[model samples]
Target: MSSLLKPFSISDGPCESGAFRHGVGCSKSLHSPAFDPTISHGATAPGCRTGTTRTRLGCTPGIYHTYSARRTLAAASTGGRKVTHPGKAILAGGIAGAIEICITFPTEYVKTQLQLDERANPPRYRGIGDCVKLTVQDHGYRGLYRGLSSLLYGSIPKSAVRFGTFEMLANPMRDETGRLDNTRSLWCGLGAGMAEAILVVCPMETLKVKFIHDQVSLAPRYRGFFHGVREIIRDQGVRGIYQGLTATVLKQGSNQAIRFYVMNSLRNWYKGDDPRGEMHPIVTAVFGATAGAASVFGNTPLDVVKTRMQGLEAHRYSNTVDCAFQILRNEGPVAFYKGTVPRLGRVCLDVAIVFVIYEEVVKLLNNVWLTD
Candidate 1:
């Protein structure tokens, strides 16, 4: 009779036999140092990438690292509890966002240029190459980054939603620090991508797209982020801010999904069998670069439509379909993906920075909170 009651008795007393009891200890451990699996397990040397924690793998290492990272986090993640690490995520997101915005602005400018056929003298731009040359000729090399001001305004919030939501959303799936698969990463990518699309992206992207594509402004060609917002609100009204929402949803959604999926996949594959924390940041960054390139290739077309739609006069196209058709008829197929290199660079940096920060911040939080 007592043997039948083993499961129920778990909550009645300490898990003296080292068995988890309804995972209460996982989060309960957060409040006390002794309960922490990570501290209890202890850290190994640099080469020991999760070598101490043995596990089987038919799955990628993102799962392994995610599972490993969760030792303390799982313990800390009791209902209504989380491993507080906002400061670290913020620092990482900020620095990475700034770098990504600066490096990618040129590509964004060129991409925007390709999509626009502003009804103007010489029809605005002959082609992407022509636009680049003209931009340099008229505004100097700096013209290639036409919307840096807006990018700065947009990048931080974009990154915050991406990284913050990724961390927050992925917290739901775990097997008491024992599961190993990239499931968490898939969810992270999906959640992060959706959060970014609906929130920060619709507006800043509209402004950047409008400013980059056309030399003229119905009101103002993004004089600044705030100025652009004011003009957009004053002239086109609030709904004017989301011109090609469907197209944007496709492009950025694919971008973020590819980014996290590939980034974590690489981390998992290279991490091999070892104690989890011993993974390499540089390797992860390189993987980010590759994943970013792949994502850009698939999603560039929708981005083109989104940009073109933003700069166009109302009724030019009711939605992304008309915008995409207009581009296909006018610019040919190649226009969809003109500024690939810069975007790849930007995405690579963004992914790397977010990963490092999230991981490092989580660790720092555990150390402080668990020790205190």
Candidate 2:
């Protein structure tokens, strides 16, 4: 009894979804014989399956006790109608991705350097500031973003697919399970991460690494993306490109679950401020910074493994476990967690950028979606 759901009443509205109401005992109409009106309606009556005329869906008199309690409300707002299911997610993703990239760019730049020069002096980049200064001093500001083109090539689409899938799948999955607990979030995150990893992420990531480590442009350097792709296939075989897929899955899956959980929880809490009441700029900034930092911190070890695994010279481990264990045995367990400082910086930047960007873009896309 203590664990039971406390009674909570949602404001009544004109429901229109084509769902059946139980016990409301059916429309004596022949078409929807199962249309019982006894149960509370989830939506308006379903459309005629065969274009049949409406049968009398009259309710029984005895069961239909009318409660005449009237209540006042401004309006039941679905928060600015949208054009498509993917629109909001895509907008959010774009915003998130843009922010993520900008904030994390420096950290990424350092990561690329570390991964490329595995044997470079100083081992991995020390602190975020040191890395930035070293990069600018040695390679120039351009060096700070050496692999940006490739990063964008993969990151944008990868993020779009990643978050879009998460949002879309989460919505439907929640509908199915009737809840959004951590389990649901995990599955949704897994599905989303896997989909993006295989499709958009793997190759783009490969390209980004190729650029960062090798200092080559995405295309032409090793042929084109396809040609480079072909070379990797010809030499290392198809599996080569997906070198760090498991690490990616680990990083992305966890990142997505935490990101979605935090963002959604916060959004729900703020729903009281309809018209998206403006939080203090500091609050937004802190949210963006903290979320990015949290995801980065949580997934840094995985990212390190993924980066090293992806950089696997010609012959490396055949599988994720092999690579992981090999690193642990040869380089020590700490090796698997290389680049923590940069990762911390990257995550902080990513979170701030993503949330702020996502919010702004959502607002814009909402306006646009509403118009169209």
Candidate 3:
């Protein structure tokens, strides 16, 4: 009878074995460090042990704690919690952006060049390889990274705001069960996209597009990133910096909505109960690439409009509607997807790297600070 009652005693005190009632090895709890206050444990949560301990996968002893910390941060960021720590999100996103830009800016420059080219202007290069060969022939390999400085300036803050805002907004709209549904994920993404578009992407893209567009000219007026910025402000005024605000908003909003929705769907499908369950790094990268590709196809038309509106010859078009109409009428439908191949490659690789870095950085931060 006493043995029968032992299971009931777990809620109040240690069992007859005279050990603390936590985890599979109750005796180990008494000798371990003090309980971490920052971590919340569900006494009867699925897959969790007593107190704050969780069951480590593959029969490991201490790995559960590290995995639990990562899971908790992921959950909070992806709308499982009511709130998120913005500072950590910003830090993680900024570092991820800095890392991604250095590796991917050349592809971005090439994509921009391809998009801005036209057969009517006597096309400079036949295709992607020819473009690269001709660019190297005319301007050296360094020309592939002509507008990197502008991108770095924009991308850091743009990425920081994007992730930070998504985390902040996602939590509030979680379903009653505290799960992020596709609708909530999309809303969070759209809000983040719009925020970044208005604050950073517009001005930075203006400078970047102008710089890259003028790379074809023998006597380019915009010598550097700052010089271009000053000239735009001097001639077109500050409004010139926001040359493509409408198209940017549409493009970015749709881009993130598609990305987060698809990424979250993949995550939720893999981890039935917990959308933030840990996956192998390869799996995460694959999911990121898929989401990035989906976004590219969905919003490439808006991207075309944005590029035209922000170009040095932006005065040729009146607004987003006009830009789209002119492209359709003059450049034809194919022009809308002129840079699709380069963009698809750039975005897929960029998103994969950004997400993998962001998650790893967040995990590192969780290790450093108890509640971050």
Candidate 4:
């Protein structure tokens, strides 16, 4: 009888030689008689606990195995971390945005200036270098960050909405192995982009462009961020701050879609089957820069239109469609890529910094926040 009762491994289950090896615990010892092999393998023993632990003493191997497999699947699917809460994502994204914008605002200023320079007879600045030179000559080097306050104010909420919405959308789309395929990643990014555009980006972007345009004007009217906002509202009404809703939505949607799709692809390729894989900061930067460059190429035309629509001279066009038509008709096709170079530099660095910071912050948060 003793020989017959010796522990034996169940090849198909988490239990090995009648011991709970997958972290599930049992109140009674596995070597006890409750685990008698003669009892039907599927039947519940008199002393066995219910739920996942039921199989600890071999009372229900089938159900416990299924539960264990599901746990394994979930861990893999989520990269062994809890799905980031919206609040945590918001904090991480905001930090990343603030840091990134500060570092890259000069390039942003140059890009906006080029985009707004519509004088065909004599372009305001020859190119990126000329734009920078002229800006420094006219307003000093600090001129390169003329409208940074508005952007800084908007960056926090813009990134918060972007990352929070992405996590919310992506949590459900991951496959059994916890991988987000390119198609699903693109959809998630698109959803996040649209969310940010509507929630925080449109008015913020409009204000930033107006500020930069005002700064360059012969007689700048706005005194500062608050004064400028109030004046804009007084003159153009609340609608002033939401000048380029359509173009912004299109640009931002495509921007994030391309960025996230590329980032996801690169990450998945790097990590292979290990969702929990950690990346070196350099590797993350490379992936982010690549993603940013892709987005810049994919949506620069839309960005040009968006900038024009939100600039101080927006009233020339009747609407978003008219705005695009006017640029195409008057400035020609090359005009659509007016600030591509400055934008490329800004966006690549911007994305690289943002991803590295955001990921690092998220990792720190995950360490402190316990998840089941």
Q: Which ten residues in a row have the lowest lDDT in candidate 2?
A: 65-74
Q: How would you encode candidate 1's per-residue C-alpha lDDT over 272-304 as one tens digit per residue? A: 443143456676566766887777776877766
TM-score for each predicted model, relative to the true structure: 0.67, 0.66, 0.79, 0.82
lDDT of 4 by residue, 34-111 (tens): 333433434345666543234444545444455456656765656554366777888999999999999999999989
lDDT of 3 at 56: 37
Over 1-372, each residue of candidate 2 has an lDDT whose tens digit, in order, gives 843565322221232222223455322221222223553333333563332323365332211111111111112133332123566777578657755675467677776565444432346555556767876886688777765665666667777887688767776654321344556666776777778877867666766676566543233356345666677778777776776777777767777666666655554355443423555545766766665666666776677667766763525667677766777777776665667666666766676666677666766676667632
Model 2 / residue 224 / CA error / Å: 8.4
Best by TM-score: 4
| Residue 161 Cα positional deviation in candidate 3, in Å, after optimal superposition | 0.2
Clashing pairs for predicted structure model 3, backbone only: none
In terms of TM-score, how similar is model 3 to the real structure? 0.79
Q: What are the runs in model 3 whose C-alpha is more than 4 Å off?
A: 1-84, 175-178
Model 2 per-residue lDDT at 269: 56
Best by lDDT: 4
Instruction: Report every candidate's CA lDDT.
Output: 0.61, 0.59, 0.80, 0.85
lDDT of 3 at 98: 87
Greater lDDT among 1 and 3 belongs to 3
**Per-residue lDDT of 264-312 in model 3, one digit per residue for the tens?**
7887788787654578888889999999999999999899889989987
